[model samples]
Target: MALPSRASGGRPSARATDTALTLVVTAVVVAWTVVAMQYEDEPLSSTLVGWALIGVGCGALHFRRRHPVAVAVVTLAVSTVYYPLSAYDGPLMVTFALALYTASAEGRFTAAVALGVITLLAVGFGEAHQTGGNRQIDDTSLFMLAGWLISLVAIGRAQRTRTAYLHEVEQRALAAEREQEARARESATEERLRIARELHDVLGHSISLINVQSSAALHKLGKKPEPSAALTTAEEALEAVKATSKDALRELRATLGVLRQADEAAPTAPTSGLDRLDELVERARSTGIEVRTRTEGTPRPLPPPLDLAAYRIVQESLTNVTRHAQAQSALVTIAFTDADIRVRIDDDGRGSADEQAVGSGIRGMAERAKAFGGELTAENTADGFRVSARLPLTTIGGTQG
Candidate 1:
């Protein structure tokens, strides 16, 4: 299996700096060893042995980041031995510095505290023994130990701060990504609903017109001596379909265009309703289907959505009869009562009484009716198919039934 890739958009890995740091550390150790060797008042062999042990301790520095605690322990052990053998000086101090850095980076607080106390005690004990309890201890060892402890604490604090900062950044980035996804999904759902509404509005009217006009054209073709007038009526129906299609397309583009531009003007055209039903029927009659309309009860004003729902139920029922019922005549009935508005469309045609699964047209009409706190039912009778829808007349704010 392949290795997993590293995360994007952060500092380079610690491994990236390994080679440079190792070379720099090696150079520093070698330079300090050479200076220490120059001041030695001993045989070359003894001095060479001492420098070799220091070199080994410095070489261990390369592994500090990968295993900081282990490197610190090894370096401390080597330094303890070197200090007693040779007087505490440059090479030993360099090893101690490396150990201090390792301990700060990786060792626990308890380990650092223990190391600090032991180092100070060792220095004090060595000083006391050399002076035979008569001379004052030098301040240099205390200062060195103090500096090493401070460096360890500073490195640990810096590491903690860096970790907290990185965690905060990651959380903010994750939240931003989730917010963007939610907005995108909401926008998509709105666009889909808008398109559905527009299609229902535009096509519903035109299809109703085509059904009425086509039946008229067929009837007129059978009675007239010449077929030209019948042909003209058919042509007019087709033209109306084309015109309605174009209008629907225009409205769809308008709504979707607003969504595409972040700073576009708000939409202007509101949804259509039942007041336009006369023009809808006239357009159908122009196409040749014979459409008869009847209205009963008081013509009380209704909410926009319920009105639109009532109009659509009639419209879809007529369109279905024309398309699949093989019907020449259709009837539309509207009744307004105290509590609800009722709509019924009936047609006398072959195959109208057959029961089949509901198609998208019927489903769309049902959805419109149900959206307004209403219900719809379609059934076949002895003579033809009948569609009835009941919508509550009561107004409910912000509800689109």
Candidate 2:
């Protein structure tokens, strides 16, 4: 957007052409108007003076945009003196017209209009001077002069209007492009969050359940010498393993189904946000996990994305507890404030986590928190592992509905 390369046609810039064309036309008009003196029809002194004045007038047209009003006035004055002195019979509207247009288009409307009026008077004086002694101003001459001046001013104003309109249209196009890009980025982020939530829930829950089952089976075999108890424990562990694996597969399918063609319906089951957190707790309870959930401030509704992120953080942390912390009890605390919300998970067990070093679950939770301008921290304490997060209400706020 910054670099001005070219027009859409991939051609060289047209500004150069415009400048060249303007100067060329100005040169031609000046030459044609003064050709009478050049053809030896006027006195040598008058012709030389006329040439000098014409040069002064036409040469200033090149820098019109820079000092439009000033240059235009100077050129108009010079041309008026030259036109009458040389008694050149030609339309004296070339340089003045160009200068007036440039001045008005560059936002000097008053000066340009005043210049136009003065130029008309100058032309009238030149015409009267052409008629030897007594000359009465004719209506046709005055009307023609007025018409030319008005047309030039109107054209200049119209040019200004067209430029302003083009600029406005360009600004609107840029704004729309930025809006579209923002929407695209948001859609991509939402899709990523959806996939991450599904995977974190599926893998965290299944792996934790599998780890618990295996730990139970291992515990039962070594602690007891009875074959009947060991067999029952092994069968229970296998059943849990089978159920967890199947659930993981089903959830994976459901999550990926959204990527299919729109004609084919994906699963219509509601996504698990904070509303389904109770069901999550019950599932943990089924795995012999004792969870204590507490709330410290008044709870307000959350937007779906944030609610899902919050729920997934809790779910992943609890899953970590079930997987690694061989703790009998775990605590989850949710604190809400007018401007912010804090979530904390603590488990009192041997603290070595399942995937302790940069686990996918932890990374997903961190990503979710970061997406909403929040932060998450996890570390081992004296008692067990702790995962704490803080999210801003202003950034992630909306009603549940």
Candidate 3:
């Protein structure tokens, strides 16, 4: 027989199947040996020896999975030695089919085919082929033996094919699941970064304004000796602080509302965009920072996402002017082109290199520009610090892909 191959199907229930095959084959062999002795007058011990040999051969079949070829060879050899020597004149052979099935299922094709042919030749020499009065019965038994061998081999081959197919399908399913998990993790990371940027824009601007207003109120309350003048300045500072705090709370609530949404629906209130640029510029002006706004092209409405990004860029820039630029004057310029929108924020503040602080505001603005298939650059110019962004109009707004 061909050498044994690795089968995809695992071992069969060994104990039950092996025990059943052994019992059935042993009974048949013992019955045949005893009846043959009736004609030969052989001693009972001789009959028992034949039965013991048949039992041992059947027991070897138990190792068919790990050593199919070896089991088939041993079983065939044992049967050959006992069958012809026992003077058997009957068609009583059985049990050897186990080795043949296993060989065809797990063995190489050439080896299994050769082993089958050899086994058929051995069957031809058995008592089943001997011419006698019971020739019809013996011939029938021989025919059945050939058919059983063919059927068993076919069954084994099919089992191997099915087991291999199942294993392949299982592997593909696991791979698909793993890939899905990886995509989910990547999406979660992107969402977290977006939330961080929103919080930074809201907190950084509001806190800077609040700090400025509180300091001014404290100064006016102590510096001016006149009760009415001092009271008026302090009240104005307090009013500014209250307005800043309220706006901060409103913006923070809107940002957090995105997380509370359970479905894809429009937000209850509109988000900030270029339309709010006036308020932003006025806020900086209130802090004694002279501001100028300029437009190069005809003003037109922009897509929502691009508009929001543009507003944040100007807002964060002005906030920086208050915190680090230490500039007395700033310029906000916006240009609309056929294919893209351009934004520039320039400050004539402490133009020193040390005035530039590349922090979360800058990174967040750059990331926002990138979202719309755009780019942003921040650098210290001789006049002051300049932050510029170019956003492509092609995919500027609407829902993200």
Candidate 4:
């Protein structure tokens, strides 16, 4: 984000500006010294010495950034000597003022102030006496010089303070950007894990059934030949495998589509939301488990991700009920409040809570609810086992359902 130096325009380069400033001050001081000398009865040698002193003082400014206080002292000493010895007056104080400004701007405020005070005192003393009838300074000029010096110091200090403030603001902006990027990376990592869990829940159940059915068919074929019965068993197993594999492929495609970039293509299949609750119920019913579902409040639209989470939690709970709970019938109740949606599945099964508590399906269900800033718990009730979940509506834009 740092800009190129050339972007600041031609003369903003500090070294180049300093060099130019030295040239200008040299010209101005030489001109003033020449004009003043024309009115005085001073010797040619004295004029040469005055010009040499101006060159030395103005030349020192080039190193002001590196040695501001030293440069200021050198310029001050040159001006103090040049005014008294020379039989003419010049604007030599220009070089000294520039040095004082540089010193204050470079964070040498105390030294610049002390030097300014010393120069003012020297001028005050010079005003009370004459330097070889030259009358180099007076009371009015001393006050004016003091005011100019104070203004230069103030301007330089203000510049330094402004620069410091700007630097602090830029640093804070960079820190905020870095923090935001870290949060984005963490969010991406969490999303990948959630997708992996969804894939497992989608394909695990049907694949397990295929494994069981195929194993049974193999065991039956190993028995003494009974042609018609064996053929019927083999046909049913193959059919079941075909249906299961087809469902797995469909869900797999849907899950994988979520990973694709936005510009490529969108998913062709619909996302699984609470609208597909009937399909889930039918699938569970085919497993010979009577599942009765009822909604306790008004059914409305919900955020797609939230809806999918709710559906997944219910689907996983029913999966556990059918797989582990040897219950005759189960009831799935969905009650909606203004703040959240609650899902409770109760089954009259003899399944032990301690055994089923450690299952991955339960953990996945809990994770799904938690993704929506909600909670889930599976415990045994008086009659049977119960799986409960509460999915919040406030987060991810309070969409009601």
Which candidate gets the maximum TM-score versus the true structure?
3
TM-score of 1: 0.69
> lDDT: which candidate is best?
4
Q: How does residue 346 of candidate 4 score in lDDT? A: 92
Q: Model 3, range 111-213, lDDT digits (tens) per residue?
A: 5567777777766765555666444236677778677777877777776666556667877999999999998898788777777887888889888877766
- Model 1, range 1-401, lDDT digits (tens) per residue? 11122445885655555556666766876787667657766656666666776777777777766666666677777777765565325554565565565555453445655666676787777677874556344678577767766777568646645655676787899999999999889867755774676466456545555455555556666787456776776676567766655545554564455446667776665544567677556554555468888999989777665766676677667667766777777888888889888999887866643432244277777767777677888888787778889888774422343
Model 2, span 1-401: residue lDDT tens: 11122456666454665478567866686677657556547777987787777777777776776688887887788766766677665444477778887788877888878988877776677567864655545769788879978887888888777777787788899999999999999978777766766776778777787777777778778898578878888887788778768766765676677678989976765665666667667656657879888898998888767777788788888887776677788888989988778999988878664445345378777777887888998888888888999888778632211
Best of the two (2, 4) by lDDT: 4
Clashing pairs in 4: none
* Clash count, one per candidate: 12, 0, 4, 0
Compute the lDDT of residue 368 as modeled in candidate 2: 73
Superposition error at 342 for model 4 (Å): 3.0
The count of backbone overlaps in candidate 4 is 0
Worst 10 residues of 4 by lDDT: 1-10
Each candidate's TM vs. the true structure?
Answer: 0.69, 0.67, 0.79, 0.69
Better of 1 and 3 by lDDT: 3
